[model samples]
Target: MENVLSSLIPPHGGKLVYRVLQSAPGKSHLDSLAKIRLDQNKQMDLEQIAVGTYSPIEGFMGEEDFRSVINTMRLADGTVWPLPIVLDVSVETADQLAIGEVVGLSDEQDEVMALLHLEEKFCFDKEETVIKLYGTDSLDHPGVRMIYEMQPVLLGGQVDLIRGRKSETRAYELTPKQLRRLFDDRGWSSVLGFHTRNIPHKGHEFIQLKALEDENCDGLLVQPVVGKKKSGDFKPEYIIKSYEKMIENFYPREMVVLAAFSTFSRYAGPREALFTALCRKNFGCSHFIVGRDHTGVGNYYDPYASHRIFDQFPDLGLKIVKFDEIFYSKKLNQYVQGNSLFPEDENDTLRMISGTQARAMLLRGESPPVWFMRPEISSVVLDSVRSGIQVFEG
Candidate 1:
């Protein structure tokens, strides 16, 4: 249906990166190479890179790009890439690897997912990278813990996909090119992108609608993180189902698109926020919402740190629409943004129920109030619990 490419926004660094193999390789060919099995994070990143979601980054990062990203939030060529996308392998695998050779990148099931054309193999100071990229070397931080637990060696090269992954929510798991063409066919030239991990809350709904209205965008892209998340977070299936309920009943039928972002959370804070902006830009988003504490984990980063970082990088091409902290006001019986306390606002107190709290209530078979969460959405969550579905990641 997409006869022509979307004319909305050009991908970061010019063109979209698609390094997947067009045809399948024979069994004898794949079985001969050394295999490097990928972890959950690397497995997801491989597909995103191949599909152009992580556009302009064809394969994993080499020493130069990896060092440049960790030290200076930019690629080796001075592109505005904020995060590292490198593959890690054990010491034994690293020893057997040779420069300019090819290796099999397989999943945990030993299925060869792609073939990596080995370009660079190197190592760096792990602690320095952890401190610089995550802003702290504390293992208590999830991002820092991930870095410390990684393999000692990093591999950088391009990948040619042999077999692509299928999603649990297959119907809504659309790729960048599909989304771009969908937006173009809808005659929407200005689409806004919103990234989230939690199920819908009143505050989330308010911010989504307000951002769309304020920016005067033509459509909205709601990309819920659907891959690996920290323990106690909403499981991928439940989040997708709850969102499906919201979009079908509540959202404007023709003006919104719901898709699953099949990637793991780095909890990389502001840098990950920039990464989202770049990814969305490739999906034909004209603007992206930088909300309070976007992609933040715990109290490691400042609440408004993401909003401020966008200001320092003005050449991102994607326009950012910043929204302040939002909470529900009991007196007004509505959600309101901002935390500034006025004299009259003293009477209008705030009521906050986090995703964790909501999950606890649902696990107890008690529904959150209508003001906090819609009954329809709660029903989906409660049904998932009642049906013995794994509601939260462990």
Candidate 2:
């Protein structure tokens, strides 16, 4: 019988999601959590769960299938705190719900799942396992009810609006080597990475420029996320247009390239930030910028945990550029670091323009403060927001 790790989830291109255990000691904040043991029986039972129960989201399994640890919940010392989570994952179509496609199982979760005794079949009301972070005793979310699974035997494979639109764009699908060559051509010895899900802000520009001017990075990779994000975020088209304008007007033409990252956003705060930096490395970037709450969601984590996590993992093979939140000061009429506020400008310190603020303002047909945005970016985003034109349309 296949274990959770080997259980085949045919939704995500047949890729089995697994965890990376045993980082060098003292490297992660997660080391203090309870350790998971690899047991053979649990592995065998996973096969049953896969065949009998796994379903795709919304009854659709795409050409690919997946089973991987969706969340990376660890503590400062590299401990695995398994949090029992209930997800009403929908396999949106029959194509995504293949016969053997497991919904929530992945090979990488074996040790942690076994450790937490999560192998039991659960009813909706059963109290699921709770795993705590290593350094702290606080348990993460609990009691997962595997409510929905797609039960389609087959699905139609056809081009949809998303695929069709993307095909029309001047998309640059690159391997690491190809991207490396582009960087190497520009004589840039190092590259600074910026992850985006919105239109570029002045603070973002300042950070990227600082990497070039101060850190002497060769180029900037304006990688944007093309995945599930919260509602009303800057559509990818807007981001692409903003970067294009930046490239055309401000940046050295060869110094920047826009790319797309096909990943979901896991607002895991610090750990997720570290994971993001590593992923940027995989794209051939030697440096990454960690901004305030980089990959953070709401009040879930410390403001500086992203940078702190990098400090814990020094050998991660990438350099991190830490920046405080950038805000616009009315007195100086420019962007300032989050930590330093102007003496005379107290009221507006809290008013620094952000994507969220800009979205609201634009939707209401208000122009953002000039200091927080470049003229072109502000105009384009506002236009898109008001006119209801998607910026990332292929």
Which candidate wins on lDDT? 1
Model 2 stretches with alpha carbons more than 4 Å out: 1-170, 341-351, 388-394
Candidate 2 TM-score to native: 0.59
C-alpha local distance difference test of each model: 0.85, 0.50
Report the C-alpha displacement of residue 274, candidate 2, in angstroms.
0.8
In model 2, the worst 10-residue window by lDDT is 156-165
In candidate 2, what are the lDDT values of residues 1-394, reduced to their tens digit? Answer: 2223311112111222222123322323223333322223223223212222111111112222111122233322332211212222223532334433222221334222211212112122122111212222233421111111212222211110101112223364343444555665666567888887777777778877877778787688888776546676767667777788988998887778887664455445676687567556655677888888887766657889877877766555567888898766665666678777655566664546566776676667677666767778778877765687664323
Model 1: how far is 30 from its true place, Å? 1.0
Task: Estimate TM-scores for all models.
Answer: 0.95, 0.59
